[model samples]
Target: MRKHWTIVTGLLVIGSVWLTACSDGKSGQSSVDSDKPAEQAKSYANEPAELVIYGAPGDPPEVWNERFGDQLQKKFPNYKFTYIQRSGTNTIENMIASGAQVDLIYDSVGNAVNSVVATGSQLDLSELVKKHNVDMSRFEPATVEAVKQFGGLYGFPVHSGGLVLYYNKAIFDKFGVGYPKDGMTWDEAIELGNKLTRNDNGTQYIGLGQSYIHVLSMNAYSLPFVDKATEKAAINSDKYKKIVDTLIMAPAKAIGYKEQIATLKRLFNNNDFMKERNIAMYVMNFGLQGQKDFESLDWDMAALPVFKDNPGMGTQPYPNFLFISNASKYKDQAMEVLKYVTSDETQLALSKKGYIPVLKNESIKNAFAQDSNVKNKNVVKAVFTNKFASPIARTKYDGKLNSPLQTNLIKAILGEIDLNTALRQTEEEVNKAIEAEKKK
Candidate 1:
């Protein structure tokens, strides 16, 4: 059995650039005492060769670098592992386009994966998973299904994440409002938010913090920021219209209520929630980065409210996938490292540093429960366990189409554009993008 090591905490840099200079797996090397005895080291020398990994720069890596990366280097000296972290999706996409033969690529599930697949840069990992004895059963079924395409497994799960509602507990208590429950409806959440908001020194704070237009589009209609199949816009659904109405429009219409469109800008710059101590709720991802700033305030988290009729389901699960480049010279060695990195042991170790584990191992589950900073374990667990439906397929045009669609939608909410006309124009613009992509 592989040795299980724990990771230690350190100051987290929200986003950092990771760069690795070119080097052969051997030479210019430093050796550390191996955990394995001499005989065992000799026995493991038969393992496959070195692998190169390229990943997006972000959380967990800053902390897990020493334990995870260093230990793997020591155990498998023959398998030289190099990690290069790029800043953004566009940078990573450029590297892939340039044919940088990376053994493993770390990226978001939908758009990033689809983009690379379009460029013919990724390998089909179905055989790799079987050969390495990856335990697919350990992952949530929906998460597993999300990575499959064209009857092939293009990638394996790395980290699983979903949206959840973050609320300042002190505000709820002050207003004599009950805390949000597991199955609370969106309408109930909105009403509760209204009750908690007030005019403080002439600055108005409505109930909930504003969400990104993209996130709003996702939760409301299960639409993807981009679509994979048609490479077109898929944002013109009735579900999205309802989302625009409730989350954007309805709130804007409330008397003395500030516009939701300006919510994110205000919260970040004005310390909207932190200052007033009256903001009821806001939605964000599971990682909860930048939350330390709110440590001085009492707060808790809840599941993103579900549509009343849509009951158990709340939000779509957005997970990151690890894929091997088809052009990699060290494909076999890379698969071995990928398997080790995604294994239950590694997943649990990474989760300790804030990345959500995809595996259902008891240790990872316990670690999540014991995390003191994570105010709402039940909400996270509920998102994983609930029988939620998969998100609707997104077209390649969705991302390009969202800005204008949201701009028009916001205008409708502000009573500038009538709802029907706004939606019709949105449909027309999105369809045009879809048609252009089809011709491409």
Candidate 2:
């Protein structure tokens, strides 16, 4: 799945009251001017300022253009907005290195936050967040903390995607099994999976299918790849080992095997598993892809099962962040756009397009309530409520460190290496990568 981040700059400090204005011979609503006090009209009226926004490719820019860009163009006659599209973090890294005079950059909080901060391409938005009195009350507390690294706020979130359990409701009903509950444990999920698995004629059904082991790893450890405060590899700890063991040993042992490749192929290609809807559960991110599949099947989503003892340890999800470029001349104007986009109205509007808006206001909740297709409301609500676990610790050298660790993890699951050896090798590789990054 593609992760998108949108950073806005040059937002006007406008009041919260609404105002009416005539534009292009049409009467419409506009925000109150920034010159007014807090008690005044809630519209943004300011001189037009040009802004260069760099964002990930696809629907995000179009949504932004519709919600804020077009409106800003009409509201501020002097401002010209230009949007540049880039795909993937590699492109972003290249653009930054080429001295791209970008005013904003969007990225995920887990992978891109520390890297961007290290590059010094992003500005601290703390003052602007405070000046706008942007309500941080609506966000999941962990999400808020995720955006804050070392004492400065590098970015603000526009939306998030959490982990959820997508199950075939038709298959469950056919087998006389109950649907997965909102809060379930790993053990319980396995039991449910066992009950759901069956064979129809010559085809076999599976209980669970997982695309990414990292998701399982996250649910187990409840931390990012690196500890933000400690700036070190924390995944080799006992807690993480338990997580790794559970995901690998439990499922492999149950099936009487240790090969993940075989498991994946068996789960996906087995006629009864996917084609026949014999599979009970598949763990995936909360995105349009899941919904697209859901539309084709009688499926529903629930929160990923938590650890038996640590009920709080749920799936790890990363939200994209918006940042202001250090090179932008129209910082104030960009800030205004940021503020406008983060507002409750805009957030709610975007939510309709299958995004979990960053704003935690009543408008967002009301919007979700009105949409019947958004069946994963409980999962979303849980994420916002911090019902999930903290992300795995990540280091600045995560690309170097995590890639190898992830590769070895896959190998371990395939039985190419034992769990203890994988862990030891991962520790060695992580320490080496950390050392290399420290030298730089």
Candidate 3:
């Protein structure tokens, strides 16, 4: 019989039903000694290797070189570092399909899906984490949970972005309405939206508008995409219906809200809130390097609206995670790089460049608050109020499921079909697709 090791409180020990691994006790002595894996393993810090970074599109090597590449090279003087700019949603998947020599992958959790985990390409870093004595507690609870869903400890977060309400103070002043304050509920936001959503001199001013993607991603109620036990699509449940009703329908009911939202999307589909200046309140994540866009406009952010029932819960977290490819021979070196990038020193350095560092260091948080160019904005509210929902455990066939669901949602919203009928049809269509996928 093979012995299994369990990861308890960030230490590896022989136990039942833990992170599945087949390391003989020949290498382990005790849980206390497990933290020395880095010292026990051969050091590759001086070995010649190129650490490939797969990040967002249009992100030049210079930006990453400045952020952490140079620091990584300084730590491992002999190792070379390079960046592979990601172009589309399937960039990493395409790399995997083509057998690219990928060392490390870093992307938003939204972009980096369960396929990486399901394909057995991402490294299981539980042991590396224990070896490095990385402080798991330093990361936010929600952030840590998000990484664990794909595979236990397969990666770590470098920075996080979450939903917040960006309100134009100038618009509020013009409408004689009080500016939105932190801790406001969705109901309160809608009430305020009613006041500000009107036409002034035929120049339409929409009160509240948030993108569908953001609203769905930041659902206050934690609804799973598929039921765990039956592996069935779970979008037609009462919980999911409430989520749609509150997040989608209620907001659309605001006066001329639909037309105004379409107009905003057409005006600047690039996610520039302040540039338009027509929308009073816009909801979105604190995107990487978007701080400068708000410089010219007099605007501030408020915490994302909470559920009246679930008062403290904000929304699911959005964090960018770093993973090592299982196929890479330099995985040990890649693990070393992963440890360094998510370290306190490295996270603090990146935070200065306008990232929400995953580490829960008081000074980093303070620095973020102090460095805010947008005055009177309670920037930290989103972090404190967040309660992350588990990422949906998806099948490879989900690509088929999302399309019909989204199409029907639009139809329901446009009065082509009722919400109940739409949900029922979506459920049937998705379950059929899941069944077909299982057959394959």
Candidate 4:
């Protein structure tokens, strides 16, 4: 029977990697000899197979094909790869719940937390790794450990990256404001942004304003939106309130609260930092491509700002993860694909395209400096200088409960609701969601 490629949506945390999938275009008996070398034997060599690959949001098919698909196809000519577009977290959850015949799931380790693993689609790859004698030690120990923490050998690391503050040097120079330094606290950064915002020649330059979603998603404090133990939204807590208050108030303090509300109504775009050159600092999950986008704009990046109390805690680590589905009929074939993609050769290939290869190999790390468009800048300090905040356990309703924090926070920022009121309202909405999920 021909397998169908499934398209579903899901959200996950940030990381950087290029992913590809390949299988024999047809499902059938293997043509390879059983007595071949173990590595050779597991290749499912010469079988016509079709690999179903489900993508996370923002990964484009063309980019995947260019990055790894063509090369993978050259390595395994008999295997045909199919790419399915991501619709959202809900879509992927539904597909997995329904037992879709997906071969691989691609996303950051964060996004996979409650969605894929909770759905029972993530396969335990410990046995397969042992059978293949794959040297898991070749990759970063932390990345490997991250996958293992998902409660089994649930996934493999592709690459790892994290959030940073990309600032426009020209904007800083124009405003007579100093550039953001690495390790600066959020309060210090905001104070600096207050200096950067001003009217220049009739054009209003935003000191620093990141998207509400970006702010909540990559909060340097890694504040939990839902307390997993209690399975309740923690929006109204003092810590969360402080974090949200700082974020919402900092930009408003910089540009004036009234103006900040007006700007929120219009919504700030990241592109404005580059094309319009009106935004001074854009905090986001920094990748090679994201850095390259600012090359012509005379910009540099600083490490993500730290919280005042948690001086060293930064945004969560984003590691690209590859998960083989438990429902996959071709475990051996899937393992082979995962092994190849995580191989040093493939890691090097992905690094050239701006991904931070998961391999601890110095050779691969050095390669990042060679072709990086922003290598001359402090890319290392910006991306690697900080420590990741502690991770929170995710529940099945985590997304539904957690997702509202962003939108409602946006409402609070836009002055439609007070921060405290917004927090209470979101907490109630999240409680309702949790209750609804329990009934189902």
Instruction: Give me the runs in candidate 3 sitting further than 4 Å from their true place.
Output: 1-44, 56-58, 88-90, 227-232, 259-275, 288-295, 369-376, 385-407, 414-416, 429-440
TM-score of each candidate structure, all chains considered together? 0.77, 0.75, 0.79, 0.77
Candidate with best lDDT: 4
> What is the overall TM-score of model 2 with all chains considered together?
0.75
Residue 195, candidate 1: Cα error in Å is 0.7
Work out candidate 4's RMSD over C-alphas. 7.3
Candidate 4 regions with alpha-carbon error over 4 angstroms: 1-49, 87-100, 113-115, 141-151, 255-257, 266-276, 288-296, 308-311, 395-421, 437-440
Across 324-402, the per-residue lDDT of candidate 4 in tens digits comes to: 8876776777767777777777788777666777777777766664465666877766766677664444345657744
- lDDT of model 3 at residue 253? 68
TM-score of 3: 0.79
Model 3: which residue pairs collide? none
Question: In model 1, which range of ten residues has the least summed lDDT?
Answer: 21-30
Write model 3 residue lDDT over 1-440, tens digit each, in one string. 21111111111111121111111111111122343543444445556655555654335566666666566655665554555665443355655655555556666666565435655667777776666445577677778777776656777787787777878889999979998877788899888887888888987777776665556645766566666568787788788888777766676666776565455333223244566577788877776226566667777777788888888678677888877766666666676776677666777667665577877677876556444443246676644545555555434444554667766766666667888888889889989988887898
Candidate 4: lDDT over CA atoms?
A: 0.68
What lDDT does model 1 reach? 0.57
